[model samples]
Target: MTSRYLDYSGNMDGELRMPGKDKHFQNTEDRTDSGLDSLKDEDYNRIVSGVQNLCIPVSATPQDYEPEPWKVQNNEDGDTLLHLAVIHEAKDLAEEAIRRSYRDGYYLNRQNNLYQTPLHLAIITEQAEIAEKLLQAGCDPEIRDYRGNTALHIACQRGSLRGVGVIVQYSKFQLPSLLTCYNYDGHTCLHLASNNGYLAIVEHLISLGADINAQEPCNGRTALHMAVDKQNPDLMYLLLKHGADVNKVTYQGYSPCQLTWGRENSQIQQHLLSVTEKSLQYLPESEDEDSSDSESEHSDDEYMYDDCKLMCQGLN
Candidate 1:
């Protein structure tokens, strides 16, 4: 037994290259090659399939691929696709989007980062047809922007008679309230038209039931008051013709005729004077004089106190 063990150790180098070990190594190389070839085949199949798909003509309906309107918004300005479409005057795309999302109030009326809806941009861009489509699609007419201006307010500001007509025509039921809607600057659609001397627009708005005598919330100045302030005789006459209240006064109790006092448009001033009540023709002199006197007295007292303080400091 000792002789056999010693012989085995002595033959270690030769035993390592025995047939069984050589066979095992050969099998491993064959299996590795087979695995690599299988991987290559799979990769080739994938490449071929991708190319086939690219070359094949696949017919699909628009409804199958159209993205949800609510999900399509600009990352920077929060403008919906409809907003950009309207801005660029892409009538077809804008109309299609409107048709798809008209019933989706949250989408159709969605406001951008600037608080402008597609309807607002439509009128801003002077796309009266698009504005009409939006209105007909049930887009809200009274939605306000960051400046609290509705699309109708902008139309009036721009003096777009067509735009105004479209908005009013589609929003007939909301006309009474929409015409009186005020922006953050306290201007109704009628006020904006009057202030900007859009005589035709003013008349159209009035005929559509806009309040002729609507007053600005900031100063209680009526459109008539604004007309006189701007010295626009034509606008003033239009207001009068439409039955604007001449006696309607500002928060400070200054009537339209009173506002015309220093204006150079004598025609405006005299006409307003003719229609204004005699009692309101003159400014409330006593009240204004008393308030001004009190302010002057308070300022005088502050000045006297400061003079006295300086005198004491100089003496010290």
Candidate 2:
């Protein structure tokens, strides 16, 4: 399990606009309605109207009522209905809430029990389309819920190609960012999928252009380090086939093969050697800060990455 980076402090009192600016909590319904009324599009207008028309009844706030963030609704395990709706494909509710949030210009949220949004919920629930819709709706893909896992992080953790596909569709999705995204212990998405033996997600992410040799913040370990140390051969093969740099040393200067040697794991050692040879022959190229030959360890075979990281290894 990774560290859940679940700190939520957005659109609070000052971030919102309300008639009664003096009363921060009053920004709830009345002020929210006013904001919705400002949208220029008619469709957007109707959405706000519908949302106000269907406002979930809040217990009458006393004139002295104050808002507590926790007072927001939650489902089992403390997931909000919105959280469950997107993930579980409760579309009618999802769409309606989505529309309302958009109309109100406040749908972008990732503050659930695990600091996840409806988009992440959709991924967890296997609702790829809903996740796609949410991305197009301008949700923050970088938001890490309580688990220090972004929606991309969770989709990779789930190891579902379809879910990863939906996430990868976003043009702004920075594949290299996944390398930096860490769970509490500082393992990257690659580390998570590899350690869990989720080969599909691992491959899909690699295909979508994740950096195979990217280092995790904790101890500067790469995904290969985690997989080999954990004795996951399937993961080792996947990472190697996808072009992970096996020779690269961790902070302690130990490569994935070193772990295998320490444990006398011949199987892993052989796999690393094979992959390292392949990587040396054909290093991959990404269009990020580290693309030049100086950064590249050796001449690559034919790995190609577009504007964002595109796992175009096989295609090329």
Candidate 3:
């Protein structure tokens, strides 16, 4: 597995408010009241107690007692009922907490100890249904965890195309940003998907316009390099078909083809070489309009010689 870039300093304390903040809040309150009206009083009480037990910390001293639920609630780690629900995989509890948050106007995007929101937890835990619920409830998918990974990045890392779809569809404002998002390691969604051999996620990401050739910050290695390095010929072919630049070299000047050397992916090297040879033919004419035919012929010969030399090196 590729190394994960997970780290953070101080805990971030904030939340993303939905658009039309005041109106959304009013609507949420109304919907929550209607939902509560539909439930038996005892059921509602149980849900409230469950949420409180999971989210609110108990008072160690009498002086710590506060009448305000918002003030008194939240564990020492800052995980809300929603966060706990996703972490515990309690779908019913998660849905109830979501309702309560809407009813009470809680911060849906609040970061816990790990700086992950309820939505992030849902996706990370592979609860696609809950993840969808969070998105439909307007949880911000763009919120980064401590590791600077948005829900989209995590979805890709986990190879959850369904989760990715929910994010891509719901995070309208964050879509463009999400497509280009880089985690702490500078790995994009495409990079993660390809590295992990998640063909479905890769296809979805590419269709959504992920930069197929985006390079990692540390190595400048694109998805193609990762695919080649991982000896995934299928992934390599997918990347190539989607317009990944075959000759793109990393900071160390090693192209995907070069990276395949000494690896067990002779097929990948051969495909890259063939593609390179074809691309060379389309190179813009180097000669001026008046330049001699001989000069153009010489340039073509040199290009072919370079191509042959690279092929020989690859074979060796």
Better of 1 and 2 by TM-score: 1
TM-score of each model, paired residue for residue: 0.68, 0.56, 0.65
- Put down candidate 1 lDDT per residue, 80-145, tens digits, no spaces: 888989989999999998888755566678899989999999999999989888888788988988
lDDT of 3 by residue, 132-247 (tens): 77777767777888777899999999988888988887887888899897777667888989999999999888998899999876558899889987999999999888888888
CA deviation > 4 Å runs, candidate 2? 1-81, 87-89, 103-105, 171-179, 262-265, 271-316
> Model 1: what TM-score?
0.68
- The global C-alpha lDDT for each of the candidates, from Candidate 1 onward, is 0.76, 0.62, 0.73
Please list the residue runs of candidate 1 whose C-alpha ends up more than 4 Å from where it truly belongs after superposition. 1-70, 284-316
- Backbone clashes counted, model 1: 0
What would the per-residue lDDT of candidate 2 be over residues 1-316, giving only the tens digit for each residue? 1222211232222222234343333323454454655566676656645533442233323463443453366766766656767665678888766654442213356476666777767878888877777777667677776656777777777777787777777734565675466665455777677777888877766776666787755356788888877888778777777777778876645667655643556787776666564433232244233646423532341222121123221222
Most accurate candidate by TM-score: 1
Q: In model 3, state the lDDT of residue 168.
A: 83
Task: Give the 10-residue window scoring lowest on summed lDDT in candidate 3.
Answer: 5-14
Better of 2 and 3 by lDDT: 3
Worst 10 residues of 2 by lDDT: 305-314
